[model samples]
Target: MNLKTFLRGIHLREEKELAEKSAIRRVLPEGEMVYPLSQHIGAPAKPVVAPGDRVLMGQQIAEPDGMISAGICSSVSGTVKKIEPRMTVMGETRDAIVIENDGQYTPAEGFGAKRDYKSLSPDEIRTIIRDAGIVGMGGAGFPTAVKLTPKNPESIDTVIINGAECEPYLTSDHRLMLERPDELIEGLRVMLRLFPKAKGVIGIENNKPDAIKLLSEKLSGDPQISVQPLKTKYPQGGERMLIHAVTGRDIHSKMLPADAGCIVQNVATAIAVYQAVCCSTPLITRVMTVSGDGVNTPCNLEVYVGVSHQKVLEAAGGLNCEPEKLISGGPMMGTALYTLDVPVQKTSASILAFAHDPVAANPSTPCIHCGRCVSVCPVHLVPQMMQVAADFDDFERFEKLHGMECIECGCCTAACPAHRTLTQSFKYGKASVNRLRREAKAAAAKD
Candidate 1:
């Protein structure tokens, strides 16, 4: 296991054997299941079941509102079929809900229990991960109880976990770390009892040597857990470069990682927080990775979280060709999709596609200042001076040269040799500095 490397990133082309020896499989739920209502990242869950309601499967049709909200179940059992807008996965349009399918997925009351996750409690596993609306399925849906709400909770210490699934045709967190490494080490000992003076590690990346030998043989003798391995690079599972490549620390620039003592998380968000706290289940189904080159039979499914994306490319055996662009989560921070009737949520891990080339690959020239976008910046910032201060509008010297800690992770438009979209000009200079900080907080709340 000679892995431990990290320092700068990029090494692309790991199309990940299309679907890394496929296996997850079980999707079923096509005639409806939209849900949306702003999948995580705070303040959205408000529906509470509507349109001819009837719901069931893990119930709770949206509720949480304050403390960094998150709650929304009902991954199919019946009716609803109407909450509104649609589209999502950042293509826009919002609201969702939908539902419909009555092919009876039934099961809802205290969902699939098999508890004794060492007798729960860290406030009963953060209220079953805030009522099983679990977020952070690792594409940044955030709000997994606001990363276990640690605002100075005694300055954490360490937890990491990220399994460094360094993206490139994502293998749904390396097949959920080679098929649930002991339910992600029992959800990393239930998030180490919510920061009991932390210490957990588990990084994993030496190209998944059988998921670091099955989580170093289920963290044998676990001296407060350890694993490590890493070095597979490319946004090395981010969260501040996996807490500076596992514990060398450097979290700063508007801090987090619980202010550098650490927290990180994501080995499929610790096995979806151990199936949302000991199998009560909710976050409607995840584990995607259907792979690219316009898929023919690339695998990894366990989908459901609102299915579609062309029913996971017809369960991965349909379009062996006709693709020309259709991402969703892994082609380096995936997204570019306009169709496949969008759906999957809880931060879908990979749906790709890309085939087109009727010949027209030209425009993308200027930007030869050649620092290879500041030598493959993995947050070293200066993405060519934040895309030349966002093409000259100079957003206050591009937010004083930090430019919102650019985690756009397109790695300076893939180390531009002048194919400079430079991460879409720092994503339109961070959407014109968050629309001028929401119009200066709506003119200071109208005085």
Candidate 2:
């Protein structure tokens, strides 16, 4: 098979053996569940239930506050304990809805009833997704409803399902694809009905040959949708790179996939869409990988959205020892988890507990101007130059260098001999630039 890929990416040890073969296991929470209101990328959800109110499993607990926000649903039947500030995976406190689990797992009215997608209209499908609180699920957590209804729906010619689970030690999506290929295809069909002219494309990294072959065979005899295998590489699943590899189209930071006549959805997100639209199941539970050498058992588990990290770790058979580091996602772009006291949100992907910290042991040295960082950059940005501009707080120079285009994939840092914090600096620089813009707008408004 001819493998497709984008330009300029580094290959690392996949390290997927830890949990790739483990089938997804469902784990119920032991105690109270905490649902953070701000699970998606936009505004935080607003609480619809008050304290002491009874809520059922799959019941809407929070509603979308802004046009860009996503609603929140309860994963288990319980009483609303309170709405208070709670610590999340980001290591910050945010308003969250807490529920005391009654252990009944009682479903709301009409939950889990199967429906025929052919009978539903495009608008009804979108509404079902929005109400179910479905988001990117790959990690971005962008609301799926808004992404499907882009500015020019007619112009979209390709709908890409991202089966490229490129991140190391993450296999939730892989398991989902292999276990439920037909459901995934059905989910794609739902989206395809929304755009009449668009053809569906499923992009999978060749490393997962089983998934690729399974999905390819499942999609056989179907002209509207096809499977495309991609060369395994770091950040191959990055929205821009994936778009380019599958469609041979390039989109910059300012352009959405819709602008390039494409729409990309994650593998797990597709399954969630299928369950939501066809089975009347909301986005309450999702499969996540809990792996790393520090854990007693590294396996993929279908965890509920509001389950506490402590509960998740316990379900993994507890830790083997004190981990040197804990990450909320995968190694490449995952966030450093300061504590296990936080609750899992819709955006949570993996919980990695490392026995040792490799990066910390390799102390940073000065840049040697080897230009290796530039060679590995998926977006082709100069990390050395961007680092200098960021160090000097030169936002203008950074902007000129297309700093915003950097996907923060950590390719530069991994490829760098000096072990410099390229991704971290770029994140800081971008935050500073955005802060300045906000300040300027505020000042202008006052004037």
Candidate 3:
């Protein structure tokens, strides 16, 4: 098989062996579950259920506030204990719905029935997905229904299913591919139906040969879909990177996948789409990998969205030792957690606990003028220069250098021999640039 890959991504110690072999196990929370309303990138969902209201599993507890937002559903059947601000995985407090579990997983009315998807129109499919509160399960948390209804739907000619699972120690998508290939393929078909001229492609990292082979064999008879094995590299699962690897299309900084005539969906998101359309199921539970040196037994667990991190760790047999640090996703790009009381949101892919700090204890030093950061930047940006601009508060130079193009993948920081926090600096600079833009817009409006 020909191995395809994007340009300039670093290869790190995969460390996937910790949980890659473990099959996804279902773990139910024994305590209250907290569902944050602002799980996705858009406006927070508006709460429809108040304190004392009973909600069944898959019931809509919150509705989308705008076209950019996604609805929020109850993952377990129970009475709403409270609708108040709660801590989330991102280390911030947000409005969340707390449900006291009744121990009975009762399905909501109009759920649990399979429908003939072929009979449904594209609009109907989009509506079902929107109502189900589905988003990009791959961690971006972009509303899936909004992505399917692009302005120029006719221009989309291909749909790419990302099975790269490139983030180290995260095996949730890999396990899904190996265990539920048929459902994933069905989901891909459902996505293709939204764009009449589109064909489907599944891009898997060459590292997961079993998934590639299984999906290829399962999709053999289908003419509309094919599988391609991508080179194993960090951030290869990124939308633009995967798009380039599969279709050889370059999406400029301000452009989207649709601009290149493609729509990329994560492998797990595909399964969620299938469930939403076929089984009348809403986005509730998701498969998440909990692993690292600090874990007693690292494994992939099918976790409900609102479960607490502490509950998840306990279910994984509790921590084996004192954790030096806890991260929400992969080490490279995942957010560090300040507390274990935070609830898992829709985009929580993995919860990593390390006994020792993964980074070297050495202090960050001055840039050695090495071009390593430039060499490994997948987006072709000069990290050293970007960091310099950010340091001096040179917003003009930063904007001119396309600092916003940085995907925050941490490749530059990893490649920096001097241990500069290039990615972190870029993140700060991007925020500053964005604030300036918003100020300018506001001034223009005032005039």
Best of the candidates, lDDT = 2
Q: Which 10 consecutive residues of model 1 have the lowest summed lDDT?
A: 356-365
TM-scores of the candidates in the order shown: 0.34, 0.99, 0.98
Arrange candidates by lDDT, descending.
2, 3, 1
Which tens-of-lDDT digit does each residue in 1-447 have in candidate 2? 989999999898988898889998998886799999998999999999999999999999999888898999999998999999999999888999999999999999999999998899989999999999999999899999989999889999999999998999998999999888888999999999999999999999999999988988888889999999999998899999999999899999999999999999998898889999999999998888999999999999999989988899889999999999999988999999989989998888999999899888998899999999999999989999999999899999999998988889999999998999899999988998999999999999999
lDDT of 3 by residue, 1-447 (tens): 899999999998999998999998999876698999999989999999999998999999999999999999998999999989998888788999999999798989988799989999999999999999999998889999999998899999989999998888999999999988888999999999999999999999988999988888888888899999999998999999999999999997789899999999998899999999999999998999999999999999999989898998888998989888999988998999978898988899999999888465756999999899999999999999999999899989998898989999999988888989889899999999999999999999999
CA deviation > 4 Å runs, candidate 2 = none
Better of 2 and 3 by TM-score: 2
Name every residue pair that clashes in candidate 1.
324-355
Please list all clashing residue pairs in model 3, or write none if there are none.
Answer: none
**Residue 235 miss distance in model 3 (angstroms):** 1.5
After TM-score superposition, what is the CA distance of residue 171 in candidate 2 from its true location, in Å? 0.9
